[model samples]
Target chain A: MEAPATNNQIPGELGIWLFVAGDLIVFSVFFILIALGQKENADIFVQSRGKLDLWVGVLNTLLLLTASWFVAIAVERCRTGLGATASRYFSLGILCGVGFVANKSLEWGSKITQGINPATNEFFMYFFVFTGIHLLHVLVGIGVLCLLRSVSRSPGLNERRIRTLESGATFWHLVDLLWVVLFALLYLL
Target chain B: MLPFFYMGVFAWSGTFCYRVSLGTWFAWVMLLIYYVVKAIDRVEQEETASAQGQRYALTSCAGLLRNLAHAFGWENELKEKNVDPLFRKSMVFCAWSGLIAIVLFIIGGVILGEMLPPLLRANDPPEEFVRKVNEHLLSIRIGSVFLMLSFALFGPFGAGIAALTRRAEKSPVFSYVQLVFTSCGTLVAVLVAFTWALMAFRPDVYHPTTVQMFADFAYFLAVFSVPVFGGWCVVIALPILLAEEGQECFPRWVGYVNLWAVLLFAPGQLVLFFKEGPFSWHGIVALWIPFVAFFLWILIMCLSMLKAVKADDQVTGP
Candidate 1:
């Protein structure tokens, strides 16, 4: 999907961007809190960070990135009036989102079975809570993607319908972007 | 004429016995009777005028009162044309309740209750908790009374918002949702104050652990009941966002504000998982952020509702 001829218009409704900016600021605060926690308890953070399954985090990261890509393409296709193709791309994005959720649940389940929980330590506390919150975003994004898929199949897409599609796609990309940051913060950094 | 004679007699009696409470009571009773007579006279005149098919000017006192009511957007007759004047006043009253609640909260929760520096941390020993409650027993009792009154005011404040949402929607579905969540949120807030008061009620008589339990209950209720408050925000935002353009009771940005509030409040849910750190009940993320955001949200909604009321008055020509 080629970029729609570069117009001055911003993608999606302006209200959606307001929500995105607010959400990003909130995640920034969470990131700052994690940094402060790591500063205060460096040894414990590192020890717990070492215990996390690195491969699972990397896989989830890739899954979300791929989902984001599909969503971006779907948005472009909808904009360019290729609604049928956009529907297909939205399904692919939803599939990737489901995979990410399944992979995250397995990782969390394994850790819980190992007697590690949010109450285990300060590091694990931030890890579970922040990632769990991000997981919720992914779930919501999947639901949004499904809605967009139905919209893509509807005939004679109007400006409002296109705007809705773009907004949902923006949210899906936010979920993916946040997960990348979470993956880095929790699993790598 | 009879009212004038009665007023003169009452005024004379009040001046003759000005030092006694009886004079004040007599003065008040006379003023009440004067108003009642004037009202009855005006109603009788209006009835006779309508029966005779002629317009009648109001008597001076009643006319002056009508003018005053219209100036304040308090006239009852405006109800037929646009928003009810009494309903508008109720909305304004409810909107101000948010400010009242914040002021009372600061005084009761922060200054008097010793919650600002957080007298009791989640990890504090039971003895420390009991000792702190004991230290501020009288103040906590007084403060909790203010706190309870403050939180109770949120019921009307929420109703004000829900009432506005009802006007915006074709169906009252979201308004009812908002009302349901508002009750839940208000109950949670009142419960927080009630539990704090209970902790201070008998800290001396109860075991240290029991006082500590009360503290925990208060903080948890305040910070951890996220869904009630968050759901309230969701219902509020949903209607504003979903409404057709130019049909929203609130500006679109207010919906974004509510959504931001929901995100800010989400951290409060983590208070259940941690006894220490930023996510703890006493910590910044769980308590301070949500606490400040909740009041800020109220303040914005209050200002917006006031604006809407003024706009409605303007469009409808008061």
Candidate 2:
């Protein structure tokens, strides 16, 4: 109750790392299960996909991929010393994140409205679980990008800070990459 | 697979040190996964000039939260920077301690339950009593989940704290101080709800009625009232922990957000009042100021990661 003796630095990087790692592990389990679950429950999984508006998934992936491209350009600019120019590209990526979230909301809304309940089947379970968690990660990614922008404006943006920024770039790409894999697994495979 | 098999064996091995069985042993495996991801992120930092490498790292979900900012919408002002070994090492130590806490916790759970007198334990033993003996530990069971969850939270939470701390001491950014304050207040509000709402209803064992749960939650919120919400706004709106590591991030005021959260929540520490009041009114009311503020801190952290990603991209670009 007495603030847990945490003075801004008690747990530190390892602490943050553990939290994110644990979360990722949980997500990984889900991802792994989804992939494996599909192998075992093919018919239902396909049926669930049939219910999915693939166009939305495809569009979302394309948009995110493009945004990742912009971010890539932005980071390259940073490497070349065009700080502000790179920031613009980063902004474009952030917009993509917001756009992705919006598209996802639409997808979710339509599905929920259609009465595609979570308890329907293993397929729906995987559908909801996979997309839902991914969406949350994407949302988190969006929030992180926003924070980076504000921090960029401040004096704290230094070389070390740049390294941290680099980490964010990698994480975003990861989100995009994972979704691509997910898309292929769910829609194509 | 072997580990999973071992887990089955270890879970029931409470008589033999449980921490040694799970926490300490598997902890290395878990921690290794952590450090490797970070190491990979550091390597990716070098390849930012390359599109593929940038994609590889960013898409992998491994890296400092700042990397997330670059991937999102923030400006890439903060570049690759280092922290003091003291701070970095301290953070690493925090991770080690967190892991140790987990290990010790399991062992503690085992010891308190199996080794203790029968009077302390419950009359009802669970089905998986052998594998899940900790379920029998009356004292440690109360917070085992909290402890484990908190331990897990350490990695990211610690990193965020360390990053912000360095921003405060070294960076000239001023607005961060105020941001930290707002974040802390939000955390206070969340904690208030969590403590009161979570405590009032022990997840109904039977088919839990949603209305009953909602009623309890609503009652808690009403009892805690708007003063706490106002407190949350004040705490979060302050721009306390605004210090930045570079030119593009945040103001210096953001640095104080978490500090203010700790301050706001300090009132709830008054144990006697919290215990005596109805609905745990005093306890819940006390957390009102700090809970929401803390929520803001978390939000700021996520946002900063995204911003840093953007800034990273900008700096990497030519």
| lDDT at residue B267 of model 1 (Cα atoms) | 84
After TM-score superposition, what is the CA distance of residue A42 in candidate 2 from its true location, in Å? 3.1
In the order shown, the candidates' DockQ scores are 0.16, 0.04
Q: In TM-score terms, which candidate is top?
A: 1
CA lDDT of each candidate? 0.81, 0.49
Q: What alpha-carbon RMSD in Å does predicted model 1 have with respect to the real structure? A: 16.1
lDDT of 2 by residue, A1-84 (tens): 576554422111222333344345444655666777788888898878888988998999998999889877766666566666
Which parts of model 1 are misplaced by more than 4 Å? A1-10, B1-83
**Residue pairs with clashing backbones, model 1:** none
Model 1 chain B: worst 10 consecutive residues (lDDT sum): B49-58
Best by lDDT, which number? 1
Error of 2 at B262 (Å): 18
TM-score for candidate 1, please give it.
0.79
DockQ of 2: 0.04
Q: What DockQ does model 1 achieve?
A: 0.16
